[model samples]
Target: MTELTGYQHGLVLGKFYPPHAGHHHLVRTAKERCARLTVLVCAASVESVPLADRVRWMREVHPDVTVVGAVDDVPMDLGDPDIWDAHMAVFRSAVPERVDAVFSSEAYGAELGRRFGAASECVDPGRTAYPVSATAVRKDPVGCWEFLSPPVRAALTRRVVVVGAESTGTTTLARALAEHYRRRGGIWASTGCVPEYGREFSEEKLAELRRARPWAHWSEVTFGTDDFPLIAQRQNELEERAARLGSPVLFCDTDSFATTVWHERYLGGRNPRVEEIADRVDHQLWLLTDHTGVPFEDDGLRDGEELRPWMTDRFRAELTRTGRRFLTMSGPPATRLAAAVEAVDDLLGRGWDFAPPLPERR
Candidate 1:
């Protein structure tokens, strides 16, 4: 379904799991700039949400672009980088053939576009090879907001990540917060309140992560909103419209807590040097999900079932001690947000120094 565009054609590939503001940023920018936007949604991703939900997320952000559902049916085997080779072999039989431009989030994606004989350009907001990964997002989505923009964060109603060790109510909190936001009429992007990443990709990198990294393979995969590239995508979307829209506040769901956990568990210990570079963000917004009565389940990644109490203690002690602007989500999501917002109100409340909340991108 590639026709009726002002230019000639365009192609974009992504899992678009509960697509966030960053996804919309890139797509809307590409759509307006290109002739036609051909979107390929990874049909076989391991997300709990349906393909329709993924598509629906895209629609929520950008209604104009044409989103194509996965056409080729393949096995769910992820430990196969050779899959790209095999899938590429299927080539025309697998996805699409004709396109003038291809947009992607990875360097490899651009390389694949070149193989498809299309003009390839990477769409990451950060030009750096290290991007905010989907894996990071799945680990702890809300805490990762430091990596996202305000609009993007707003769109990530599903991205309220509650991170910590065993019994911290990470899953329960994620779900509860997600529900709270939805009741308030916002889109919540998340890994279904559990920790998983790269649910949709070439299966090659995913497989490699599963094998070689095993304990930390999923650490590298950040969501579309977790890094500079995602934010840059947001900027360009507006830049194309007006050139300078200032910096957008993107909300990240997780951060070093995710990486730190992986490193400590598998790699022996955390590094001060890496922490220096990784400890980047404006606030922590920590929530001690571990209360006495909360129940936790071992959702593949986490093994904390008697959720709450212990995990909460650790997260609060370490993260809070970091000397950052962190406020624990004390009660329910609504109550926590209210307290946080009110705290902001106290700080910026009646100050003539404050500016109104920025107008959203058109």
Candidate 2:
């Protein structure tokens, strides 16, 4: 997360049960002024199906936005005033606190920003483009959800998420492949994988020690799992999105599978989640990279490479235990990315229509 300044940040809110053109222009304009934009989707429920639907719909339209949970720290009750205030607080807390400005359509948002000491404005979609909204869409579900913003419609088609461990080129390959998919033009985004929690240990002495065995806490629910919750949560969210739109949705940088791998290797066995995911997944492409050539570099959370071998082995073993075959790219970074692009092409060719997504910001 970076500091927000110079009036470039804005908050776009909506259920997005079905995205449309007006939503597109507003997001597009906001991105132009802000280095980053955050979208706050109003979910109708927390049940897996509804949540998944929203996430999937959003993924289709705003492919690059860092989609996150809004109800996590607050109640999802739309009618509860205390809960409503709490909801705003939760989003405000999770949101990049330092934003230059806020974007909204609701009347209260302007006043809300003023009370909070943020510069805010309501961008009038009615004046700029087709202003059809959820109300009209609800009145006609088939017609409305069908006609969505180019970005939104494109975002909804199908998703591609790349998964791997730290130092592996998941992020790099994700972006490259995303762009490669975009050239074919439908909707695609290289969603970056989640950050590792191990790096968060701030105890200088304990951190330096690297935790003897590191397996003790692997099964502790309180302690982060050998199979991290982020992966499960990520899957849970994506599944909800797919179920919501009644369409196939994809997410990259999964946690549970990656977690299952680590836990199995640590415990010298398999985690059931890994087994379920192998056949459960529509497709899985694992990138095997030897961190030997790459020097240990801590990008904020990734602290050291002493454990790189341990992490790599767990990922590999998990792939094997599940009988999941992966693509191994052992060489320079560029070579790996090239191979990944080709492999993805082969996979998508199996059934993907392969439409180039909307044009990304230059």
Candidate 3:
């Protein structure tokens, strides 16, 4: 290892379960005191948040700090001597550079500093400075939203999924809500929407199939239960990607649950994997767009103009059956959009307080 000349290097280590304002302040404090700082993000397999995600959050806040992940499958136990030794080795390996000082906000810094032959500097040991903990943040992320960064906030944001049958304007309302929140500024500047992945995939398939066979029609494309699992997975992937991009409140065009409904209708029953994915997706609200006399245009893929009411009822039945929170929407596009915007605003306003009868679901 290369030895530095005169500059003093500091080491700050923590699980950073999800880096919050308290951790941010601790890192900033260390940076101000030392010429160079290296933050060791220790992650265990049993942690709720992934190691890669925690490292990303640390880097986002303190880019200049030498952020490194100390990933280990070993259980974390400060009480056991063997556990401490394993952790110390993990830390040392992560940062080979000689640590001139150890910075932390806990009593453990002293012992860790001794192992490195460095001074232990505790910042805000009393927790009075930031008055928060990782445990508190985990319990209620929204309650502690003010202290969290954009990436973390986005992860914790509640999703309001828009679902409907043909010509019910799910995409229109989704786009409108996304745009409104994004332009509204403040924390919502990070808000955006996940476009329907199923439609995009179908469009691509149509183009490719049509080029190969001139007689190919949209209805000719037979979709099986297997196709929907990929669709559901892709939809979630897009939603998660949007959230990382800073969209705290994502307006989803459709979610896995709605896809499951389609699966049941077309394939006789929902695929096991699709059902599992749907069950796992955490949606705060399901905005069901009603077919209120809207003229259905031939979208090529949608031979489902006749399938509107049936599909809509199927969607409603699924929501009701699963005991999921939902709101029923009817009227002109503008009216539906207005209602959706209002519901979302209320949803955000109350910090995701859903006491039912918000907009009334059929």
- Lowest summed lDDT across 10 adjacent residues in model 1 is found at 242-251
Q: Tens-digit lDDT track for model 3 on 1-362?
A: 12432338988998887789999999998887778899998876666677898898889878888889977655655567787787778888999879988988987788889888888888998888888888777665656767888778666787899999977888888888888888977767767788989889889888888899987999777777789999898988888777766545888999888888878767787688998888776789999998868789787888878889999999998899999889998888788888888888788666533222112112
- Name the better of 1 and 2 by lDDT: 2
Pairs of residues at least 3 apart in sequence or in different chains that clash in candidate 3? 190-247
Clashes, model 1: 40
Residues 1-362 of candidate 2 have per-residue lDDT tens digits of 23453454556655555556666666666665566677766554432225455656566667766455454424344345676576567667657456555676655566557645677767783544565775564444334544554334334333444555566666666556545554553323322233333223223224444466443321232323434344454564554344344222233444346656555434556556545553444444556665657666555344435777777776676568767657666677788778777776665455433222222122
lDDT of every predicted structure (CA atoms) = 0.47, 0.52, 0.81
TM-score of each: 0.37, 0.41, 0.70
Identify the candidate with maximal TM-score: 3
Ordering by lDDT: 3, 2, 1
Q: What lDDT, from 0 to 1, does candidate 3 have?
A: 0.81
Best by lDDT: 3
In TM-score terms, candidate 1 sits at: 0.37
Summing lDDT over every window of 10 consecutive residues in candidate 3, give the lowest-scoring window.
353-362
Model 1, residue 358: C-alpha shift (Å): 39
Query: Considering TM-score, which of the candidate structures 2 and 3 is the better prediction for this target?
Result: 3
